[model samples]
Target: MAKQYSRPSHYEQLMKKLQNDFPGSEPITGLMLIYLKHIVHVVETSSDMIVKIVEDLHNMEQEETSCVAKSKILIISHDIHTRLYQQWSSRTLDIVEHGIEAFDTNETFENLIVDLLTQLLKLAVFLMKQPKLNLKNAMDALHEKVPDLLPQQSVVHYLLEENDSSMSTPSEFLTLYQRPFDTSLESDMVWPIPTRLFPYN
Candidate 1:
């Protein structure tokens, strides 16, 4: 679906339809970005309109096709209380040069999305920071931004990796695989009250 929306004709078609349907002449203020399948859509509308826009998008997809990949809201990467880029606009991603599939720098999918975001925001900043929603201009804008940007903060920043070493023992990452502790009921209440830590017990 991301690839489908990347094409100029398809992109334009959707944007045009959205504009006509909603009929907003307002400059984009808020973003509801949903990332899936290597695509992050930072939908630029007011906060109120975001859910509507998302619903509309899904409806359009369902109308055309017959299935939906994911539901309306999953903030893959966002700080909802804060808007990261003031100068950024909608619909500016160069999937080719900044190829997502080729984004194999030992990062997780969640982190890769953030990396893509860095490139996108930097691109918006590069273009003297304005919304240029034309085709060649959008493409041109994307390419220009790519050369100047780097991954500002990658997933590596957060994770505590140990010396490129491999572990022999099984990870304790999962807390439980057994029945936490076995429970037995001899009677409704045991005669010699066994020790229990919490009052809830």
Candidate 2:
């Protein structure tokens, strides 16, 4: 007889809980759950794309590829970044329409938003550092297209220039990102719980 697995994986349990708790009966809860699910899907898909982009970059760097080819890769990366920002902006709007009070009461829901924001910040930083991708241009586009997407003290502001020497590690980045939220209740209310992204670190 085959051995039986008694324990469900964390992801499995989380999915089961989500299905049980948010059954799409109420309008607001259903909308929030749908937005959260979309956000998770975007993050997962974008992460996989980023990994592939990084691997391609490595190979191109090894081959000393032509500027045109590198430019094409940069364009693709920028497009991915834009799509993520748009998705995040849509999610934010969904939350705002549903009201922060709705989410603030639920610790698990708040934690999920925090996790999503952290992943987005990390991805943004990673993409910003890629060669030939103009960070300023990307920010300008986001500002024009999704002006209310990010708060005033967003982690995007902490992104280092290619020549800057400070805060190379992700931990350092998180520290810089968390400083603005330490005393601002308004910021806290508007955004997710700003803390270290990696709990184990």
Candidate 3:
């Protein structure tokens, strides 16, 4: 006699458990976390591009070479901008608004952005072997474009230029590094989030 084949009910049970655990908020929370990770990645990548630009500026020993490098930097900047916009738009407002709330809307996200920028600045210093980029101007531009990107108490204000020194070490920016944040912040609230940061606005 042929052995009897048993239908697998294990998967069905597991699926039921997952649905119960998630309840009603898991999908939104999951998507938000994914978007947040991409956002940070994009910002970090863009910051590195700026560092590369600074490096090109310093490495240019001749006017002709400098122009070439500048052209390269411009091209890279344009490319970075395109990438950033694409990623930013793909993220839903529900995720960002929740993130803002999850971070306490105080300065968590702001600090994150500044820390990334500071790292890029330090990388620029090493790659260029000199301080060719104006850190202040770049920061100022960032602030103008994205207000409050750095927390007031964060090191961004004094990382590049302090009262006693003109340049700080890369270690200063490292302080921003934190363990992965909680993805499922509010597991109970199920509502539509308003417009968070409208890129078009």
Candidate 4:
């Protein structure tokens, strides 16, 4: 009978490998991975819905398609956006609740808080970069994501700028992600309407 080799313990293997990695590499890498994974989850979930809605819209607009089908495909982006926001929010909270202070960063805890905000900014950029969603719709969705910084004037700001122009989305909104207490934003917030008969801003 051939002698079988015993497997090394995971902790032992990790300890052996840590010598090559930086002091905090494991935890930092783990946290970064978690953050990136959450981002991918949100994007994947949102994009999947966006792609389906766009496909439906395209099918409805086809020459042989019926009017009923066209109506069904319209503005489904809002629903997708709403659900995406909810997912991002919940995941963000979970991250915070799970020993958020344990991460080792060069900056103080306050700065780490800022880093969390930047993650939201990255997510917003990712959402807008999705080609299936129009600029107007992207702006609308972003407004929902960052209500405080964007406020009521956000859509107008988004509209006033050229579609190709790059604007940095705010990070402040991410601080509220996944919190235990319910936010009071709902009562005070109001999304602006075009208010014109022709729908021109």
Candidate 5:
């Protein structure tokens, strides 16, 4: 399950809670795409940990707490053996920075959410297959020397700031709800993904 992306601050709290609740050593690992107000999350963990996380997220939303968020989850692939990632981390890319232009076309937020998740998953697998290439961060790879790493007219558009060193810009910083990104993205193998974003999927 995932929570609807909340304010950067709230998401920050959520990230912190996730880190603290599930330590680095825990078997849980997945990706989080903070797309504007929606969070497309893929959690690869044990069944028990999954339940605990869902319950914790529910309490966070219903308890009138500092962070108000909820998740309507899609089970990408379950009862799997390998984990795609070594640790749990998030990438906050509001590609459509304001969450406005993506809807300028005739598409529901749900559609955009699926598009992002599908795109990112494919991109992850592509990166994994690259020989002698260590593309640790997708956002960083966007601006790096590898033109072949990404396709032209990318749907996942990330605009870096003028000053490369500055992590203050909101648009460039998907790291915080506020840095360009907090952590890089990584994955190991491909897996079957759910097309729908609902639990029914």
Candidate 6:
């Protein structure tokens, strides 16, 4: 007979506590919280896996292990690397598609999406380097390269500082959609004629 597995009591308790702390009152806020939880889970899980792989590599090197054992370890490490890469790519695409939709209609929400995507991409790049490189050097390079992934201050800051009186709040956006167009600007106008007439002799 196979043993049935269950979640740990502490894990369940923690989940319940988090749910209570962050109830879904606003859609964007709830979505952001969900994304945070997912990113954290991926980072912790990938970090643990990488640490284990690194330890295994160290042990194999110290013991002068056989080529077969070393190859097996490398294979396992490669598999983990591939899995993590796939997850990052999928998540990136998902974030980008959602961001595009929000960008088209929801200005405030689009900013949040961009920020969230930036953080996720940075974390993904950091994790991607762990399987086959020196951790400290990889992180140093990553820190240097991070600016390339982020938006320039001129772009995002300009959007934040610009005072557009026409910008709509969420409630205003809903009301604007529901209301009919005025069409006042479409009315025709008359212009005065010039009074200069030439008298020919």
Give each model a TM-score: 0.40, 0.20, 0.17, 0.19, 0.48, 0.22
Q: Which scores greater on lDDT, model 5 or model 6?
A: 5
lDDT measured at residue 97 in model 2 versus the true structure, 0 to 100: 30
Give each model's clash number: 0, 0, 0, 1, 9, 0
Ten-residue region with minimum lDDT total, candidate 3: 28-37
Compare the candidates by lDDT and give the number of the best one: 5
Task: Kindly indicate the candidate among 3 and 5 with the higher lDDT.
Answer: 5
Candidate 2 lDDT over residue span 1-201, tens digit each: 001111223223433454455565311111011121111212222333334323433343345332212211101122332332212212222322323222222334334345445554654554445454564455445535444443322121112111233222333333443477547556568556677667784
Cα-based RMSD of candidate 5: 17.2
What lDDT tens digits, residue by residue, belong to model 1 across residues 109-140? 45654565676566445543445464347435
Error of 2 at 10 (Å): 44
Give Cα-based local distance difference scores for all models.
0.40, 0.31, 0.29, 0.30, 0.47, 0.33
Segments of candidate 3 deviating more than 4 angstroms: 1-52, 59-82, 86-146, 150-154, 162-201
Tell me the deviation in Å of residue 35 in model 1: 15
Candidate 5 displacement at residue 26 in angstroms? 5.4
- The CA lDDT at 6 in model 3 is 14
Model 4 Cα lDDT, one tens digit per residue, 58-177: 443353533311111101123332322311221211122233234333544344334444554565555546565464465445435544432112222222222221211111112222
Q: What would the TM-score be for candidate 6 when compared with the true structure?
A: 0.22
TM-score of candidate 2 versus the correct structure, residues matched by position:
0.20
* Candidate 5 structure quality by residue, lDDT tens digits, 1-201: 233445546544655676577786356666655555455456777654655555555566566652434444333356686565654556555344343323244554455446655665665565455553454555344424333432222232221101223122222222232244555434323255335556753
Sorted by lDDT, highest first, which candidate order results? 5, 1, 6, 2, 4, 3
Residue 133 lDDT in candidate 3: 69
lDDT of 4: 0.30
lDDT of 6 by residue, 1-201 (tens): 001111224233433444455565211110011121011112222323334323433343345332212111101112332332322111111121123222223455446435645655565666566765464454345435554553332332233334343333223333444588755542233345444488768
